[model samples]
Target: MSNPESFRELCRNELHSGPTSGLLSGYVQANLLILPQSAAESFEDLCFRNPVACPLLCKTNDSPYRLENHDRYIKNGHFDIRRDFPKYNIYHGGELIEQKNNCVDEWAEGHVGFLIGCSFSFEYALAQAGLAPKNVVQGSNVSMFVTTKYLDTSGIFHRCPYVVSMRPYKVNDIEQVRQITRLFKKTHGEPIDWGFDGAQRLGIRDLKQPEYGDPIDIAENEIPVFWACGVTPQLAVATVGQSIDGAVVGHTPGHMLVLDTTQVS
Candidate 1:
């Protein structure tokens, strides 16, 4: 994980894989979404409207055949959105068609790839603050839950419920954790809620059965803290994919794209 290019190469060849939670420390990571040009405007608007849930980093150029992070932001120009992530979810006609290690063969004209800010980008700062990100410490992906709360609908995307990533912290350290995360606004910023029954309020009934990622044990003195997730867009499209033709593409839960940019503050 010392070299971003080497890690990406492992992904490209399907050699190294998993939730990139703690790997490649001191670099920014992103959630990815790819859609047709016809659906780009609405999705972009959706991101702007729900900044906490979908902070946008960059979008691919008009050439849909390939989507790369903006070169200016990356130290190396060899990353490919389609093949760099550990896993990808493909949708069609409102249904999840399949998951793949690489989707380079699927890219076509009119497709636009989006790079969204991920809470993973702030985990390093959290760790430096002595508040170990539970998932990283546990060697598991951060647990994600689709909540009952709904995001503001924009254009063709409608009724998308908010998706949240959870981490447990000792009650006394929760406030300091929130302050550290708030400074990383471009990377999810702050905890939406924390404490006992907080997840229940967000409509999560069982903490053990998270919709995505692996679950961690909540210690006796720790509280479950929540953050807005970039996966919100996928949930939105799944609910109304018929309107957009059901051709959305994104990274599978917990498997994010690691980038060279370290800090945006």
Candidate 2:
């Protein structure tokens, strides 16, 4: 087995750039969050309520930046959360902003850490179904968008809308797409809706102007399909709670936490 800490150091050393899609190969990459104790309980409840966006993979018992993964941390003497991740986004007073690679100094004992399953888990399932993602198709990041919809009331997070990712495919491939992704319920299960009409319902109108990822052409006989993206929560973290009254705190959209688990298991 490879030394996870060494890999982390290497990622930080030089190659720790760009999308990590094919880098880890089979690891269960995750969406991350570090919130104050006041909102942690509500956030967890929101995650449980809307399992699609917030899968609720794992959480730390105490201050976020200071996590004790025991085994992983022990195995690597240098298991510092701040510098470990290639990048991070900082959310303060509900506003978000990108931070340099390290944010450990900003950590307070009151913060809590959260990790959620990512759609990356189903990449194999997607490939197995013969419907490899187009983001992977065009060698770019996945396209994401914010929606007007909101999850049922839970707490501070209940007011946000579900974010979604769009992929164009032939009508013929739709069935295979469903059958394959349906099996990965722990991840983002079957498509919530299909075709361009559904895409519009999700607040993603421009196929060419994706918030992320390059636009892939839609075949004359095909339509754009939508999936309940895990990135939804991240987008919420990035866009929610921003008011024009001099309150614009937010986080970056694409950055996610990479988990210690691997999909190749």
Candidate 3:
């Protein structure tokens, strides 16, 4: 499962359905967000307003199930948006209604698919620096939390909290981790904050209870490090509430779509 094409085939055929971290190393991974065509423009504006959490890679309004001409990021010709992701979350009226292995039955003609930059894309570089995330080392999904900090609002999108992914590191190793991750500008560059003080600044009360993904145990000298997460959009959609007329689709937390390109600059 080292090759992106082969890994994608497993996803397409429903052979591999789990968190995508630590697999397909050296390749870029993306978070999927499929929105109704009517709200696509506003949602794009939201992404523009909040680039750290939602750094958009590429988007298409042509086909909901496939990417025909977009080869720069996703080089696989057989890539399908509906079936390539390990899991999908379906949201209606700002509430998650169902989780599915594939979105083949949920996607429609006017749906727009967006590929957002994921922090998972930068994990390979961290491992290269001997700062691999504990979640990757433990074979679990990264812990994610909805912070009290609010994102700058766009048209029809408001009152959304900034979601952050957490990783634990020794107090001394945090500086090196920050230095290494800062190079990945496209995939949530650097740590927004580290240590327990950092978590409090973001209004997170408890580290044990995460909104999404698994919680990793923190060692004696280690502290929780937080980063902007792609799941912010899913929270945004939920916070926006009844403003959206139709259902929204997104990749499940920690599960991402692997792209062929390795360039994150």
Candidate 4:
């Protein structure tokens, strides 16, 4: 990226080749979902019913993720969901079969984009409260796992197991994390479970082995805390094969969009 405007582009360049975490700071990271316009209304409605997993921050039209209106109000559907972010996945029958940097040429006429809320918001909030993510401090990505609990569903989209992200927390400061982060609706608010026992309840096999991101140091007496992840929906979108054969696009976890709107402080 040559300048600030090229931030998303730089993450794309790197993530297309490697992973994106701790690289794009202060940008509002997002979880992405792109589907045919035919399946969009149903999916959009699903997101509405389950806002936590599918916080529809924005949407764009069938075009490749883009924005043309400078002074007027804009629609996310207007942006091209394919190439706007770092990565794209082609899911066929609820299975992720392909991954790419962009899907402009691959996308057909009917497509819709969804930018979902991410953990970065709360992580940023945690850091502001002096809770440094061990992964971030160690220069690694977060560890994610699937739990036994299911997400509240809206038909067709059956109840799917929760996909959770774990970050290590010191035993001493768990309350501080709960106190400060509970108010933010944009991020996963507060802690659902604390300590390793909580992780075990979900049948998490390895406290150290994460399905995504890098593993970090878990100091003695430092318990791993889990939060409902945005990836939860992506997992559901994958498991329930009803709306499969469409281009699915998302931000590479950390390589988020730097939006013009700021939360009222």
Candidate 5:
């Protein structure tokens, strides 16, 4: 489904359920994190401290099941946060307990929904620059890894490591890829590191074994490029020592909420 609205409808109806990468090519795709009001403030602060990993787009107001107030965040009036996502992970005391197609039953009053900008949002621009991500080309989910490097702690959210998404490119094309992705400030602006040495610097021991999403093959001359991923928030939710009282919810890795807005300016 090329159209975002219709595609969203399919998701809403539970007709579509899988990774959303390369599906809605030009539209902005967002990572969904729904936290109880008790944890919302601290999580927001965590995002503020780590903008590269969690570029927050907009948050819901009083409505727990719908995104409100932000015009650019929601283009469809009927967009339901509970049902729009392809899949949701329910975490209890930092452990994933259940996966659901729709989180309507899990979301409670006073819960706030945060939409984090996704790296997938910039893939169209990357393709335009002739630097399309390897996962997109191979019809697979982007490779994501939980790095040894930790993010700055914020309130109850601590001990969270940096989760990075990887894309492969030729050694010579790295500079051009950097130039193109830098324009997308809201969608994880630029590569944090590139090349094999770069991946080693981030403490990634193996490129093939990713914590989330499918691994893409790196060609002989191609090098793997790393970017801070929106999935960092999920890692934060899981690793935080202070257990959240209520259930913490997030979009399943590689499955994202497709937004109606165009590429971030």
Candidate 6:
């Protein structure tokens, strides 16, 4: 996990198929979304309005995937949106069509790719602070749920509710968790909410079940802390896709694209 190229090669060879929470520490891991040009503009606006849930890192057309800023693009090199990630969720007319190893075949004409900030960036920071994220410790995907909270709608993305990822921390360490996460605003920022009654506030009644990711144990002295998740956009795409005749593609929960940026370090 120390080498980016090696991790990519593992995914390239289909040897990996799980959430990438603690791997390749210090490098950025992005939540990837690919939309048709028709839906791209509106989705971009939605991200702008909901920065905590969908921080925009880079947006580019499919085919030649590169960051928009030319100088930075040169250093980051070219990434093929279709094959670089470990897993992808393919949607058609808003329905989840399939989960695939890669989306190289689905990058049809007019498709655009967006790279969004992910909480993984801050996991590295948390690790450095010795506040080990629960998912990393358990070797599981961060638990994610669709909440009653609504995202600002733009264009076809209508009535999309926010999705959140939760982690457990000792009650005493809650303040430290907030302070460490606050530094990575581009990556969902600080805890949106926390505590024994936290899930109820978001309309999630059962902690054992989540819309995405896996469940973990909550210690007696621990409380649940949440962050605006990148999964929020996928929930939006599902809701909006039913009404519109289009599709949205995204990385499967916990499976993300690793970047070369030292932004977290």
TM-score of 3: 0.91
Better of 2 and 6 by TM-score: 6
TM-score of each: 0.89, 0.81, 0.91, 0.81, 0.92, 0.89
Residue 119, candidate 5: alpha-carbon lDDT:
82
* Candidate 5 structure, TM-score to reference: 0.92
lDDT by residue for model 1 (6-115), tens: 78888888986687877888778878888877788999999899888888888887763244446645575576778888998898866788899987876777788888
Candidate 4, residues 23-133: lDDT per residue as tens digits? 344445566777777667767777787665566676664455543332121223233345556666667777677777776765677776676767776677677678978
Error of 4 at 28 (Å): 1.1
- Candidate 1: residue 7 lDDT (0-100): 82
Error of 2 at 24 (Å): 1.8
The TM-score leader among the candidates is: 5
The reply for model 4, stretches above 4 Å from the true place, is 1-4, 9-20, 61-79, 252-255
Question: By the TM-score metric, which is better: model 3 or model 4?
Answer: 3
lDDT of 6 by residue, 196-238 (tens): 6877888888877878889878888888888899888887887
User: What TM-score does candidate 1 reach?
Assistant: 0.89
For candidate 4, the lDDT comes to 0.65
Higher-scoring candidate on lDDT, 1 or 5: 5
Pick by lDDT: which candidate is best? 3
**Clash pairs (backbone) in predicted model 2:** 26-263, 27-262, 95-249, 95-250, 96-249, 96-250, 96-251
Predicted candidate 2 versus true structure: per-residue lDDT over 1-265, tens digit per residue: 1544555675456356344565555556666676656666777898889887677766665643345554542343545554555666666545564565656656656666666666776766676566788767677677666666677657666467787777777899888888877766657777788887787677666777776556677779888877787766655554444421222211233444455555322
Ranking of predictions according to lDDT: 3, 5, 1, 6, 4, 2
- Which residue runs does candidate 3 get wrong by more than 4 Å? 65-69
Q: Local distance difference test, per candidate?
A: 0.82, 0.63, 0.86, 0.65, 0.85, 0.81
Cα lDDT of model 5 overall?
0.85
Q: Count the backbone clashes (under 3 Å) in each candidate.
A: 0, 7, 0, 13, 0, 0
Q: Tens digit of lDDT per residue, candidate 5, span 179-228?
A: 88898888888999988998889999999999988978999999999999
Per-residue lDDT value at 155 in model 3: 89
Tell me how candidate 1 scores on lDDT. Answer: 0.82
